[model samples]
Target: MTQEEATRLIGGIYDSIFDTITKAAPGGKPLMAPATTVLSLAKPSIAITPKDFRNPWTPGNPTAAGIQPALNTAALVDDAIKLSGLYTQSGVGISEVYGQVMDSVHIKTQAPNPANDKQLDDAFNVLNRKVEQTDPETGEKTTKTVESTLLTDYNTNMIAYNMAQAVYTAAYLEAQKTQTGRATWPMLAPNYQVPVKIAYDKWRSNFADKVEQAQSIMQTSSQNALSKAFKYAKDVFESYGVTLENVDKAMSRKIYRSTLLPSDWYSLT
Candidate 1:
């Protein structure tokens, strides 16, 4: 048979088998697209011209114009027939086939803590500290003493939190396959439960490290903001000749009316 004919024969057989299995499955439908492998006949051609009997001494040099058996069909048939079995298995919706495809793709889901408010708080704390720093040599102070409202924007922090949650969730799901007393599924027989658990544990540890890193950043920012606020308060107190007690009194009064001022303020001076 020609190579093209062999390819068609094998492909048709595999497709038939695949359809049968898909129909038998619980859903009675194929989960994926049908796959096909095609083999083309090798057509080796040689051109002959009226060059005369220039090389009459050459062996098999027929001085005639006719078609030659230039294609090899046997090898093509052998290979195509052998590969048909693989195609049939793939079409049957085997776990190995689907697992390979799933492994290559990532699915996103909602995080347990979608807001990541804690992580945001930590990040803000860290950034605030840096913003409040005063260069000892330059004697230059930060323009803003406190963190801006912009720092509390939750979008960036939520994304980081979600990424960490994804890693954790993936690890957890992988670990659940080996839970005690669970019936072993035929598809997962190749892998031991212990090894999968170990891998997932490692994944969880890495995710924790990422969360800590994020929290550390926020802590530093918060410290910076506190430092800036403290410095600003100290400078104001020194300029006004006001004692800490007077400052507290001023803050406690709801209105600046003289009647609302503390009675002991002048005695302290």
Candidate 2:
């Protein structure tokens, strides 16, 4: 399928899934309007913030939900480039995913603790170190140093980073099985952004908490298949929108099956 179709399918799924899951709550509402309204990844919404497992006060962590509004909608749109860099867009192996975990751990553990790290550490470091000013009315001269707010990765959290990689790998592998080398994930969509993120965080949590239990919920015949199908989906589409089901149907009705150079167990096309 084309990128637009892929995007739409994911969006529809998000819109539907959120509608369903939120309904189970006492009085949850749709986080975003719909796909048509919030049109592109360039303007995706942070409808629901995932729980930041690592930082507990960052975007990926649900507990840190309050921190998101600091960006506002305009800043959210502006920060797309920085946000996208959180994960490896391309597919990777278990070792790579593990490495991602380690990388995040290292970043979060930075000494002086990250934030623009704005302070010039050099003994002779200076940013307007010598400031001078003259009070015209008082005819007095004064000089002082100006300090700059150090900017570190504002949303730095090892858990979020590693979880992002896990989500990326799952989405990429699923795309490989379902749509060639496509990287058009609904998580990257505007309307579907929240639901997709929630789904990913849930998957990550489930995997972390109870891995063997994945087979029952994911419906994969084998543990390996569960890994390739991108882990956990028991009934995401069946419960909400039929977008995923439709993708499979489209593959079956239109695209002919063929042997792949290096096929994963879950893929036969």
All candidates' lDDT scores?
0.42, 0.38
The digit string of per-residue lDDT tens for model 1 on 148-179 reads: 33333333454555565566556556656785
Every model's Cα RMSD, please?
35.0, 28.9
How accurate locally is residue 157 in candidate 1, as Cα lDDT from 0 to 100? 50
Indicate the TM-score of model 2: 0.14
Candidate 2, poorest ten consecutive residues by summed lDDT? 148-157
Which stretches of candidate 1 lie above 4 Å from their native place?
Answer: 1-11, 20-31, 34-131, 143-269
Q: Model 2, residue 8: displacement in angstroms?
A: 79
Reference-based TM-score of each model: 0.19, 0.14
State the lDDT of candidate 2 residue by residue for 31-108, as single tens digits: 554432322233353343323211222233334343333222213222223223122223433333433443443212
- Looking at candidate 1, the ten consecutive residues that score lowest on lDDT are 66-75
